[model samples]
Target: MLSALLHVTLPLALCVLLTRCRLFDAVAVDLSYDHYAEQRVEHLPAFLAMPCNCLVNLLYIITGVYWLLRGTDNAEPEQGRYLRQVFAFMSIFYAPVQWTRLAVLQRAPAVLDQWVTLPIFAWVLVWIGFIERGAAGWRVWHAAVLELLSVLSYGLALLHERGFEVALGCHVLLAVYKGVRVQLTHGDARTLRNFMFAVLSCCGFVVLKLLDLPLARYRIFQRFTGHFWSKVCDVTQIHFSICFLTNMTSRTKKTR
Candidate 1:
């Protein structure tokens, strides 16, 4: 338990400290925007942006724990109960995967480790599809299809040299499609906007990931820029989507 706490809590603490200290403020201004975003440092804040991101992985843990208990506490209808339970199972996996990811990033960050993160993202994609759309017949199939395609993409990536890139592209396209579908189908304006933001964040995650390796060679980007931005994009894409789901679900119950 102590070992687990250090793994999970320490990076979060450093992130909070960096945020509170405004250690990145001066650097942010120095690399200020020029409309075109030439310097990579302009994107640094996304990586280090406090509170939201600092607690993202932690949020996954909390969400996981909550889901573990949700089955007993929340008495929502049985219609989506199975789906919710599956989501809980995924959440249980997600928290540890996130911790393992941090450990890998700290010690021996590799493409393989990065690839491991994809399953969690894939699960989120499927969950959002199910929850936002209501688990009608077509919706259930949609989520399953998305999961199958995601797995196939990863499988392809593992089999070939540039397979990872191909897999990443496929997943990004699929995630965007799902987000856009929600945006179009949902009547609520806030829900629509949240889905739109989720799509953009998903794209941002892809871009940051693709650039991580290339930017690592540069002096300035090497100074924690790659890892920082990667975490930022990861948090933005994943956590915000979860918040949107939770928010919409609660509002949905309130209305009904």
Candidate 2:
């Protein structure tokens, strides 16, 4: 219990506290819209989108490590090995982008930001494909296609000056579709519960993030609600995603 508290709950609390620290705020990326020519504004604490995204990604890494160390060995050794690689690669590819955006290249152009984030979503789609289709059904071609669509979606958002609104909407819809499909196909109570939890977390994440702009302006919302709730939801979404995927994989292995 103590180990779980220290490793699991402690990290989450620390990350939430870290988000409010003025030091991180000092290093946050300038989020002013290039199209609008608005003066550079202070980054929002609720913008747990990428800068501090590594915090949640750390949870993913820990979860992956736990599975790799303790998960039951499957008959398909190669598949297990490959899944480990995918998890490691995703964590490696994701962390650098967050660090770069937050600290290394603080003033980097938004286009660069978009390019780095492209892989993040592509990896997500691939992970979901792995859950739904198994190793045999998971294909690079599908991930490539989804990556292309993500690029186009972001491109359109940039041109229209909405700044990833449309792209995020599309990704959320895609995630929901994937989760629903997995539940329908698997027909497991635990998987269904995880899916429902993820859906709720995703909904909260989207709503809080979208409202961050308007709500975070007010002192009360910024200090007490908007930023805090957004971070909580964002982290919850990631945690539950890891839980869902890991649970699904465990079920698959057990059934086999």
Candidate No. with top lDDT: 2
Q: What are the RMSDs of all candidates, in order?
A: 12.2, 10.3
Which portions of model 1 show Cα errors greater than 4 Å? 1-116, 128-149, 213-222, 247-256
Estimate, for each residue in 77-188, the C-alpha lDDT of model 2 and write its tens digit. 3544454445444443334444444433334333444443444445456666766667677775676576566655655543555546666666777777877877687648
1-256 per-residue lDDT for model 1 (tens digits): 2332343245334433433443223221112222111233334344333222233456555655565455432534343444444544444444444444333232122332434445555755765555565534335557556655654455554356566666666666766677666556542777667766767776676676557557766787654545446556655555456555555554544444
Candidate 1 residue 123 Cα shift, in angstroms, is 3.1
Residue 51 lDDT in model 1?
24
> Highest TM-score, which number?
2
Error of 2 at 109 (Å): 5.8
- Computed on alpha carbons, the lDDT of every model, listed in order, comes to 0.50, 0.53
